[model samples]
Target: MDLPGVVGTFFAANTIKRECQLLLLLREYVTSLTMACLVEDQCHSTLCDALVQLCIEMRSLDSPPALIRTDPASGFTALCNNDLLKQHRLSVRNFLRESEHGSSKKRIDLSLADKVQLLKHLQLPGVSQASAAKKFGVSTSQVSRLVKAKQQIFDQFDTGNHNRKRQRAGKEEEVGSALFLWFQQKISQGARLSGPLLKQKATELAAAEGSEFTPSDGWLSRWKSRHNIAYKKEQGEKQNADFPAAQHWRQHIIPAILQAYNKDDIFNADETGLYYRGLPDKGHCLKGDELVGGKKAMERITTLVCANMSGTEKRPLFIIGKSRQPRCFPRDPSRLPVDYGHSKNAWMTGEWFAKWLKKWDGELRCKRRRICLLVDNCSAHPSNVALTNIELKFLPPNTTSLIQPLDMGVIKTGRVTTEAD
Candidate 1:
């Protein structure tokens, strides 16, 4: 029996149900009063007497639940600490139980064809339910259920191709088709799906179809497994808001640029923010922690990275900061890994980009080769920079995030390598 019913029965049997109820309320009230008295530093003489009387009556009862008694002598800090520990333990246990429930395996029932074969063999005069059960490697109870639903099984066999198992009553073939179509539509729009969000969308679709569809966790889990649906980390990209613009760039602009320049001479540059001294935001933490202790390293710098399509030449990083020179920098500026630039906001500006291009031009002056430099169409990128050896080509708006070779893998890999080093 459930605990509540058992507790009620015990109280009813003892003929002190009312007194037990009163005692519980009195005990709770006394505890709160004592805690309040201690906090206020007021005399709890009357409260102590009431607590003593409640305790005596509770012990005298036929059956008494365990009561936690806290006195002012224990100190308010100790009382609060005990309460915190109790709450923490309870939360941990609940989390573990939920995890176990999600991970637990349920009995997998036989498919319709298997059930039909088992029932058909049992129908043969010589075959007993036990023999059929043994042959099918199922229990006698399962065999009995098959026998009782023999007509339904036959109907399923006749209606279905018998190649696949029958879907559950509520989960029709239509529902699966609808869900698949929804997933396709979402993917086309570049929207990501979590389990809860998917469930909510499914529920909405089912409601619109005039059918009830509240899928269990197990049902969703099995459905995904059957359909080969999986969760994957999506690459972050700026949304392609104008398809025509992107198409124009890819089909016409990029082709024209490539025709004029060799792939080795093609270079792409992009900037990304970095927290040089801090750990990644995603990491392991203790259970129930909302915030981690210790001040986080908030020091940030913007790194303008440049690379070629052939992955041959990686230019020195254009490190933008609030100061002209940070203390961490080497005394000899030319010896540093990065060419330092400064802005009030520590972000790339058109002036800095022009200056960096001029510096790069100085490096390429000896080669006498005019190179195509691909950059994003950010406000910080100069539209009218006059250079002799370099030709600036700004990518179509919003397309650089994924299309640019520097943003796609080169810069990200560079950051990871630098972090590792």
Candidate 2:
């Protein structure tokens, strides 16, 4: 018998007997032992001594010698398991083929460059099809096909679609390019694209092109990743603003006032609703049923929050609540950091805005600064209000996100900090 057949039969017998100790020892010194078996006498006796010594070592280990799991009917399958291979001093992990690709028929996805290299090896003299397949870790039949139709493969490679199996399956590059272009245009125009929205757009485009294929969710996700498109949390939606008007206000009007007043004099005021008892409905000290039935949990307070762009000044909060004197309020509301007001629905009206504006005007008169109060063009804000040393500038309609400095983050930070307290 040949040396290869003899070695193969010996390992097959050991695997059937589940001789884990012999398997471990073989893994450690298989290369050197194979050389010795071919060149020296009495190598089998030497191997038997090594296996006996390995059994003693196995007893000391916390776990039994690792064996590959298999169906009982299939008999022992693997020559040596991963655990024994890992413990070997030589670390021959790379020498062993991966278990996933052990089958010859499995299609190996390779780049055009790699295919070219494999084909070039096949072109060399004395390289048989089987040897070339082993070298490239593919089936012998695949190697034969590549050698037979080398010219066709070269043409496919040159076209840059040789490795793109999905294109052959149904997806066209032209459709993908069109979808990517639409995505880019939408993003550039400040439109937010959610997962569902992206999938919808892809389906619409496929229908319009009269193609039966609609991109699956997985395909759309992969497309985004392939194009390096990332999803981010949108702080606010960008509405179309009157660019000419906004440009004039920022470039012409705002700059013109710098000579007359300092940065501290410029203030932005905005209103926000606070759900004061907005704790998690669950996981609190109270029972879930108690929280579900509680009135305090539903209570909300509307507050006008103000901050100067220079960050040098912050106005006292003006809170609008449904009650004139809530149970939580002190006898003297004037001592609180926040100014209190009462409303039927806890909403700020134009009348309250006018009064609040006047109150700030009196405070500003004492500060002796020429005030430029920037406000949003909301219905609550009074358009015509008489004030001393106070110039009210209403931001263009729907342009609060673009112009209001407090909307940038001041009010949001204040809310979060307050909630923490």
Q: Candidate 2: misplaced stretches above 4 Å? A: 1-174, 186-214, 230-237, 280-297, 419-421
Instruction: Estimate, for each residue in 1-421, the C-alpha lDDT of model 2 and write its tens digit.
Output: 1223221112211212232122322322212232111211112223234433443343244433332222111111111222333353211122223454555533544444446657887779998878766654567776777778788767656644322322232255556677778987998888778888877777777778887666787787667644546677766645666666777778877887676668888888899999887764445544445534344566888999887768888888899999989897789888788888889989998888899889888877898867888888888998888998789888887667677777777778878786773
Give TM per candidate: 0.54, 0.51
Query: CA lDDT of 172 in candidate 2?
Result: 53
lDDT tens string, model 1, 223-301? 6644547788866666644567777888898899899999889998889998788775556667688646667888888
Model 1: how large is the Cα RMSD against the reference?
A: 20.7
* CA deviation > 4 Å runs, candidate 1: 1-171, 189-194, 200-213, 231-235, 282-296, 419-421
Which residue pairs collide, candidate 1?
none
